[model samples]
Target: MTHKDILLVEDNPDDVELTRLAFEEANVANRMVVAGDGAEALDYLFARGKHAGRDASQLPAIVLLDLNLPKLDGREVLQAIRGNPATRDLPVIVLTTSAEPFDVEASYALGVNSYIQKPVDFEQFVWAVRQVGLYWLVLNHPRVA
Candidate 1:
């Protein structure tokens, strides 16, 4: 029942726009905070760099991560999140285009809550986003930090 922010760690502009549209169309109430790359996402999560003034205690409800990214890359970002006690339990969904078995296995091994391949079709993508919102934002119960 508690509404928390959603962190979107993605570098592609087109994908970002599509995600935004999907969330909007799905009527997801949580605010989406975008980080263009892995480093930026980490900065925001840890309250460093441009996000220095942010309250680090207030973490996002879930993170939608893309494997291919500039700077740190999603695997590194996932490791960092898991390594940090403050963010270890935060739900992370790997929303990526990669359908590779290794990628999926690696993500699961790194403690990703879910892994979803990006649908090429607009409607399918929207449906996936809606399902994600419904599950992570509305249904799942996270531990109170």
Candidate 2:
């Protein structure tokens, strides 16, 4: 399958820039859609508000989510996605700073495919982003077409 795009839901500007650069360095040709909050992420996914007229079939290959977000949290966002029949099977990876056991368990319970903690070091962060992009965007076999 082709790497179409990735939805990156991150609140921090530095992390967003790093993730964008990492995807570029990894040679990941897919587009990166940045959503600073959970609400925007949902809008992008469902083609609501400013995202109106978006083709629902053009869902991103992966969603990199942060737990702490404005409007709606990552858990609520995950539940919304999974609850919808159209995006139920979409691949969502919880990538956040929190590695708390409760966060990990709750994310998995919400149907997150993978849960990863952000690295503090800049270089390590880049590497982690590359790895995630590679694994989810290329190596992962999706549950649906």
Candidate 3:
């Protein structure tokens, strides 16, 4: 988190590998850390549980969160993040396979920075990942011009 890694909160192993490969193919330099469940994701962000003693102040540059997850789910995680002042300003993007209107609307309502439906095609998915990484990590600078 201190290095501004891209935190990917996903339970599906295949999706995790695909995203890692996509980011690699896209040549994104930022490291990606995986949290297999919502509770684990929160633990990492708050530096609790197994991630204890880690500095909580240095959060990830961005989070790619999946909605369907075990142990708390993405909505709960997002709520916890937004509710805490320490992580309220963190940029969180909902990257899920779900394209349901409710999911999209709810994510925005929960203060998500972006809602992206995981593209079915590999090439398209890679492109999406590349654009996302480029925009968030390089082109867009919230603190500096």
Candidate 4:
């Protein structure tokens, strides 16, 4: 099996840096791809726009998606991902600051694999990332695409 990378869809520079640091602290060796917004994320996944010619079959092992994003929101992104046959089964973990019940329910309804709230404390954030890496990268058995 090919080594799959992780896709992080976020608009915040600080959050992006924090996620990178957290993954490093967890010793997760998988490559990380950053999309500044939902549109970029879609492009990356679909190999369109600037991501043209990318191997569409080489999908990310997991997607850490933020609920609030520019261009298109995370919910819309999730809907698109699930709507497409090529990316319908891709694992998406909604990593955001929102703890609203509606958001959680809607994400599940859209077929998100997991939902995680961003931790305010740096250490907690690292721990959360570590757990995510351990479970999704190390243990989860993904469906054959």
The digit string of per-residue lDDT tens for model 4 on 5-90 reads: 99999999999999999999999999999999999999999999999999988899999999999999999999999999999999
Off by over 4 Å in 4: none
How much RMSD separates candidate 2 from the native structure?
Answer: 1.4
Write candidate 1's Cα lDDT for 1-145 as tens digits.
6678999999999999999999999999898999999999999999999999999999999999999999999999999999999999999999999999999999999999999999999999999999999999888888777
The local distance difference test score of model 3 is 0.93
Tell me the whole-model lDDT of each prediction, alpha carbons only.
0.96, 0.90, 0.93, 0.97
Tell me each candidate's RMSD, in Å, in order.
1.0, 1.4, 2.2, 1.0
Worst 10 residues of 4 by lDDT: 1-10
Stretches of candidate 2 above 4 Å error? none
Off by over 4 Å in 3: 1-3, 143-145
Which pairs of residues collide in candidate 4? none
State the TM-score for model 2. Answer: 0.94
Can you give the lDDT of residue 132 in candidate 2? Answer: 87
Full-model lDDT, candidate 1: 0.96
Candidate 3 clashes between residue pairs 3 or more apart in a chain or in different chains? none
- Give every collision pair in model 2: none
Q: Candidate 2 lDDT, tens digit per residue, 1-145?
A: 5657889999999889988887788788998889999999999999998888888789999999999999999999999999999899999999899989999999999999999898888788778888887788778888875
